[model samples]
Target: RYWPRFPRPKTVLTVKEVPTVDAAFVLQSVAGLAAKAALRGGNRDMVWYPIGHPAYLRWHEEMLRQTRANEQVLPDVWAVVEHFRRAGIVKGYVLFRKDAGDRRLHQRGAYDPSANVATVLAARLGAVMVSEDIEHEARARGLQRLADARGLTEEQCYEHWAAQCSDSVLALVDPRVPHCRAEAIALDAFVLATHGPLLERALARIRPDSPILGWGAGDEFQLTEPVSRWALWQSATNWCLNLPVLSTEQVGSTFPASSIRARQRSLWDLTWEDGVHYTSFLMTDGDNVQWLMGDFQFGAQRSWWNSPVRGKFPMGWGACLADLAQLCPYALRNLIRTASPRDDRVLMGGGYYYPDLFGKSRNSLEPLRLHARRIRGYLRLTGTSLLHMNAAKWDSPEAIRAYTVFAEEIPELQAILMVQYAPYTAGKGRVLWVRRRDGTELPVISARFAIWAHSPFPDDGPPAEIAAKLNAEPRLAEPATSDAENRSQPAEVPGFSWVTVHCWSWFKNAPDDAAAGAEETDQATAAASGAKRGLEPVAWCVRRLDPHVRVVTPTELALLMNLRLRPEQTLRRAVAELHLRLRTAQPARRSAARGFLDKAREALVKRNYRQAFLAGKNAARVLGVMP
Candidate 1:
């Protein structure tokens, strides 16, 4: 069990106000470092809760109430520093500038060498990294204690720490060059390139068998911009190896307990007869721990779980259970405890690190296998069976077959939600199947439609346009005549459309305003609203959809598709269960189950999927296999 005994905090230090984005970023980095250091020092006596915006203070209070933990307010960032000092955890401070000048310029954005260097020095010496620019503001905000306990000025302290770390190996990267950042991140965990010593030190501190920390990017950074957050650098300094920071927010965090407990949700719960047009809406990017701890939950962009439209429709959230368990178990527990049964469904995202480039060796399957074993453990811990995955090479049959390693290792995994940045490149409506040693098949369901803010596809158009396209699509509106026809079509399973909506995409206006030339305004409004913009685009799309279309969860869509495509396998599982249950049943029930089983087998041969499913359900009921 990865269920850690969380620190029962006697004192919850709340940072009620932060001066700026830069200040908030520095404070959070310091807080994470302080928390880790305090825990390591055998003083699990406090929890650092920072609320950058005053509007989100209620969320902080609500979290405290749920945990039954009382709070002590730290009025400013300096006060937070003072508290850590008073606890005898922090010894000194290392200061750096947010802007590193021309030394770290990139075409996309500049990387801050100062920030990266500061992180290394802070960890090596027991100190907090603060932005040099914030000192004057901090002093103005009532900084009575100057230079920490070491009695050294910010520059003097940085120089002292730098001198000690002068011999440390550094992997200098040029962000302006294409694929350089990606290469650096891919090698950060294993090799000592680009702050490798810190990772090595961090790995040495943890158990040899412990799951590797896949500390992804920060809330402020993008794939092309590595300097904004320096999340990986911070993680490395804290003794946690950083995984590929690319698409960090695109992955997920924390699986809900209910998802695991209800893993046996009947495949027959959703049937082929449910509707003519079937669709499952999944929100992407739950893997970033900092994003979840920052804006996604409590900042201006807090429209996800707290949305007013939540529970109004079925939706799946992609999360990384392993990362949450290690970094912040309380947040994970809070997510599970507050999840809505009607709307909130958790699906594993990216599987520890991004599966596309997890291991050091690209040609070897051993790394993939090792990662799968760890993923299997996380799946069991989180009570999740479905996974949302992405691959660098997904077009070829060989590329698709690589995922069988996951299915082979994680026997309980029900299905995989395959998403790529460019869906058209992988072929439209692709569904790949692989058979295991025991003859069971695994499905890799490719996303047919996507709604992302920065998507480059024509299909990822406005909500109204996409909805209209769906309504006009004949394959989704009409049922397949034969299994072969269903298998051959670009729509994959007839009447079902697997839609992946990026978490960042949302609508600001009502459906009417969205259609009448407000599309541009929607994007602008979404950006402006920050955490306040809920899932209005989803509701907008739902309203515009044809009456024949039925919205369902990812689980429902996967099970329904499996039943439609593999009627024989579906019936076999039900029949086998019925036979086992019948051993203890009365003679009348056994006879009745036999009759239903026969009908199911006959209907399967005739390709009467609805009849076969109904017969299987009846057999399960007769044998007490289902209620």
Candidate 2:
């Protein structure tokens, strides 16, 4: 036997001292750096060690063959065998009976059961199977392969795992590791940033079973989420106290009740004023397109609280909150038609006028991002995407600047700057520059004209008149010009030339007589104009406008603006360059357009102007423009 000399006398050394072992090899095989660090940190559950890759089938076959034949093995091969034997990797799999449980176990390897078992046991033992350098790429590949095989997308896989497994589950990325312990690390960061510990704890202390204080029409109201029926069955229930139980006829005759008692106190005591606040909470359920066109009606009040003679609905967040509860599901589903991590397309957009006035500042980037995230989650769950325009509350230059910064920071969201009212527009919506006190101007992202009409209220003129005015009068403002841009411009610009009008009266509660009056108006308009029954006045009027006057949504408006506006003749220059490239292209490069060019040349030579124009038009169309 080979023996190594020790520092002390050999006679004094035991038989164990005769064999030489490298300290580095022993430290690596027995107690790795990651393992030693874990031990030092007192976290025994984290027992991961970077050992080796899954060995090829041939490597194991040769090793087993050598062992069975009683042939000598290399030192490195002997070390691997000795390490696995000592670690009980082979024994652990046999004890667990993994192969017997899963038919797909053999897919990973064609080697003997023990060889495959070693790799499986190492994985089960929390070993780091691959180097950290390729971890991200490896996770991506794993997700892709699973998605390809199962016919699911990578996002779907992540969502499924998040719902069924853990919110922090990285299973789509790291199948070999099973589940990661650091899954909720990103969520924790978000929670800390948004809802701090103090607020979280304060909200947590409120008993869920306590009676919820809510105000709205009871029987007439339609909750947005369908699970409201289940919510009533739970202990933390919401009771809408003001049900307009009286019929429209009885609403007038009944005396106003004095006060109500609930949870050991009069409801009047909680109020600052002796008179109760009148709030409007309307819910419209139907096709959102019809709703957008002002076809939907507000729910019947049939109660004294919202009696048109005694009180008017408050126009603020209290009213908006009620409406939001009803329209949330619809807005979340229909408003945002598409979403993407990188898509800059403007599919749709709309502005909320009162979000910041009530407190939740949509003018800031964080709130917008948070709102986007909420919609993003909903869209991803349903496998959809969309774009929206969230406007600031105030219509001042300061508000515009704040919102512009928000939009600039998050261009992917494609936010369009807006304000509730501006002196220049006087609340009649207009996309004009507001000059600040400091003489700086801010560009508002709405159309130059807006028609705000409340139905049954009569502030906005009849739909026919408004529609005719819009078609005949509204036009996009002339493009901003610099000295260098002296080229000719179109005399009449075409497309959506005004902000989408607000027909809020379409959501007003009305008396039976008033409802009949509206019906009469509808019938009269239909008879005179031959418009379709049940169409909103606005929709009817728009249909009557000149066919060339387009009715575009806010998102479509943004797309058109970006498309038509040339920043210092950027679009013009690009088009010119494309034409130049076409004209000067080599024969082989222009071969695709050679036939059109030849036809146009022949027609010009023959003095056939019409034929020449036709061929030229075709060639221009092919070049992505018209002559």
- Global lDDT scores for all candidate models: 0.52, 0.26
lDDT of 1 by residue, 103-210 (tens): 433223334345444444455554555566666654564433223312232234334543443221222322111111111222221211232234334333322223
Highest lDDT among the candidates is held by which one?
Answer: 1
> Worst ten-residue run, lDDT, model 1?
242-251
For model 1, the superposed segments whose C-alpha errors exceed 4 Å read 1-38, 47-49, 52-88, 98-108, 130-264, 293-302, 325-346, 350-354, 360-362, 423-426, 453-456, 475-492, 506-522, 525-534, 582-609, 622-627
**Residue range 1-627, candidate 2, lDDT tens digits:** 000111111011001111212211121212221222222342221111121222112222322232232222224422332333344321111111112223231123221222112122232332222222333533443311111112222233223332332121111111211111111111110010011222222222222211111211111112111111111100100111001100001101221111110011111111111111111111111112213211122223211112232112111010111121121212221222222211112222212222232112112334333333333332223222223232333455544544444334333332243323221113333344433333333234532332333233222334454444444442444342333221122223322333333423232222333422232234334334433222243344454456545544333343333333322222232233444658766665466455665676676567553464455445555654532
**TM-scores of all models?**
0.70, 0.31
Weakest lDDT window of 10 consecutive positions for candidate 2: 1-10
**Candidate 2 global lDDT:** 0.26
